[model samples]
Target: MSIENVKNVAVIGAGSMGHQIAMLSALGGFETVLQDINEKALEKAIDMLEQRMNDWVNKGKLSEEQRRLAFQKLRTTTEIKEAAQDADLVIEAVVEKLDVKREVFKLLDQYAPSHTILASNSSSIVNSKIATVTNRPEKILNMHFFFPPLVMDCVEVVKSEETSDESVQIAMDFCKKIGRTGVLLEKEIYGFIANRLLFALSNEAVYLYENGYADFKDIDLIAKKALGHPMGPFELMDLSGIDVGYYANMELYKETQDPKDRPAKCVEEKVKAGELGRKTGKGWYDYRKEVISR
Candidate 1:
């Protein structure tokens, strides 16, 4: 399971994280495939990737030849079996549902090669549980990449009780090959590493906002400036999409079955009203015609 032996990588989701993963794999010189059930989403991922790669070249972060190579290595498709067949590594980044993941892993076990490293980008679901439905539990682990994997440098290599030393080493090596700093976690925790800490602060922020502790902007401002973080919890939540934070809050609460972990009503209410943050052009703050922060 050497990193050098991994020639192809298949990312089984076309959303933000999956698209980012595919781009990184291509940039790292692996044949990368992005597959999704939604054809439109797959197309969007490819187009956005092309634009981002061009941007990298313009910024002198990547050579034109390297950019062309990355584009050549990237592929998009809708067929799971086709994508899994020759992939040396298959990462599942689908919706964060245990049963849906179980179904996908079961199929992956049947279609993907025996030596393929099956990983989930799930931030919270237990890897051991997802692995239970697959044939090679040791080959299945959580390779949790941060949002926008192309930029952020940390990869969480989550190991379950069933994870083999070889499997863990392989994952860490792959992360390094892609120019990412890797952290090894002994057991599967609720939110892996980044998201767990993020959501902890996020939940508190929601509590503050709903209780009228401060104005929305103030809550966001202090978290960014005073706390010395890149973005405040609300701003981060907005950038990540409010619905994402809402679902994460709900999932965390269910995982712990604790009221303390429960999300505030204000968050759910916002999600219900379709104020889904950056993607939707309205979250903690509103957006204009441009999709980027000002």
Candidate 2:
């Protein structure tokens, strides 16, 4: 269907990206459902959403009435069938793994109405790969939002070879309704645009630190002071989660069999130690103690 016809939006996976996406949809006046299998995760997501909106209200970025109305338009669910049954658009923000995303899309295809558009928030793995498991490939495309969906204004709207022009237009219109700039890519590519550039910069930073040529903090200092970056590569990784970069790198390595695409040794070690990032309180930096470096 078209943007005007999109009355209900379902966001799968209640983790960082999914919940915030549902908030955006709700703020845009759609009946939004944020769904996850874990009830605790769903509860936590709602709590976090409330806190974030309250913070915005205190900062004068959002109004009390707007926050109340947005909450009124949003709901949480544990059942996939319940979330997708009446959805006009389904945005999957599950884990970055291909198999998991494919399964989510397959189930969405089965439960969502035939007119529902399917989208993925994958950072690297293209929606073309996920669409293989669904019959409505023409309605499936990438609606990749950056980290912290509320703060990020740009979205990468990528269309696979099979994605219909109508789907792309609808996705762009939906992004506008939610206060985001949608940059449409006519063809799919690994990492789309921004992440490809980021991967190259992050890869070199990891290499220098791993090789002992420079301390991670020193590298970050140089990136910020000399390169004019607001956040150093390592700090960005920690904020976004080291596990996310590790998994994205692994996916790239698996596809191209490129040794350079493999995750750095330190990333693997941090992930194994459960030092995922701000969420886990540790990564390259320790968030719990407010330490810049481990």
Candidate 3:
């Protein structure tokens, strides 16, 4: 299907990335449905989108009328069928697990229109793994958005071996229509492009910290001051969630079975303690005491 023909969009899972993708779809004039198994998460997603729209109005980036229209285009539901029934495009943004993603795609394939393009927002797990469980592998591709989809400009469009060229173009066009720069990958890889570079740096950073070379904060300082990075590895982990990075590393390790690909001891410990970064009020930094207290 062509981008122009895709009038309805379904975003499965209403976590951080899913909600933002749904908001962008609504902003792009598509009738968008945001779906999650948890009603509370869906409610939170709607609240966040409304707050963001209000912020845009306050900043004069969006008119009140435009904001109202965007909300009109957005709908929330807990029912998977209700969300995917007539959707021309379905974006799965569930947790980073291959089995879970495959299950989501299987349901999507059952409910979504036959011509609907199925895309995943997975950062490390490729779409091909999920596509194999569905009947329409040709329609499946990866449309991996950044951490915050509304703010990020670049989206990685990954084509599996079974993904059709037409489906790839439609996915690219959809990204452009939603005001994101689409970087197309002809073949699927473990981390795509950006995540591969990011994980490599983070792995080394964790090694340095564990080996007692320097404190995480000092390392973060060096990355910001010396490398001109906006945030240090620890800071970025706090913002993005230590659990997220840890799971991504585990996914890579499952694929490669390399000892170097294992999750860092620090990451595993933080996750075990439920200190999952800003969302949990703690991670590499303690947020409960002070805002991002390093």
Candidate 4:
């Protein structure tokens, strides 16, 4: 089906990325549904979306009528079938695990209509691996959006060998409809474009920190002041969730069996300690006090 055929959109996660993505879809004038199994997560996502929209309205970035219309277009559900049954497109933004993504696709394939295109917002695992479980491999591709989708303007529309050219074009068109710049990748890769670049920088930063060459804070300061990076690798890790980086690295290691591809000991330890960054109120740096003060 063409981009014109896409009228209903389902976002199958309510976390940081999924909620913002659903908001963008709603703002783009599609019938959008945000689904998650956890009731609290769904509630939190709705609350966050409302607060963000209000902030945008206050800042004159969005009109009150636009906010109201977007809200009218968006809904929430806990059932996958309810979300996907009538959807013309499904974007899966679940955890960064291959098995979890495969399972999600299996359900989306079963519940979504035949014309519905399924996309994964994965940063590491390729869509081809997840498409193996679905019947519509040609409709499955990576629609990888950066973290904090509302602010990040770029999206990677990655196509696997099985992905049709029509599907790629449709994804690109949808990205434009939602106010994002879509970069089309004719071939699939492990981390797509941006993340692969990020992974290399992050890996080196972690190496320096782990080997006692410098502290993470110092590294971050140098990156920002010297290299002109807005946020250092360690700071980026905290914002993006250290667990995400850990899991992505582990996935790469699983495929290549390269010792260097494995997650650094410091990262693994942080994950083990349940310090998964800002969402958890702690990570490379503690945010608990900041949260409390706020």
Best by lDDT: 4
Model 1: weakest 10-residue lDDT segment is: 285-294
lDDT of 3 at 58: 90
Ranking 3 against 4 by lDDT, winner: 4
What would the per-residue lDDT of candidate 2 be over residues 1-294, giving only the tens digit for each residue?
689999999999999889999999999999999999999999999998898999999989999999999999999999999999999999999998988999999999999999899999999889889999999999999999998899899999999999999999999999999999999999899999999989999999999999999999999999999999999999999888888889999999999998988898888999999999888888888779774321
Ranking by lDDT: 4, 2, 3, 1
Per-residue C-alpha lDDT of model 3 across residues 101-182, encoded as one tens digit per residue:
9888889999988999999999988888888888999999999999778878999999989999999999999888899999
Alpha-carbon lDDT of model 4: 0.94
lDDT of 1 by residue, 114-201 (tens): 9998999887776898898888998989998887788889989999999898888988998888899889999877787788788778
In candidate 1, position 40 carries an lDDT of 99
Ranking under TM-score, best-scoring first?
A: 4, 2, 3, 1
Candidate 4 lDDT over 209-250, as tens digits, reads 999999999999999999999999999999899999899988
TM-score of candidate 3 versus the correct structure, residues matched by position? 0.97
| TM agreement with the true structure for every prediction | 0.95, 0.97, 0.97, 0.98
- Cα RMSDs, all models: 1.6, 2.2, 1.9, 1.4
Relative to the true structure, how large is the alpha-carbon lDDT of every model? Answer: 0.86, 0.93, 0.90, 0.94
Which has the better TM-score: candidate 1, or candidate 2? 2
Deviation (Å) of 228 in candidate 2:
0.2
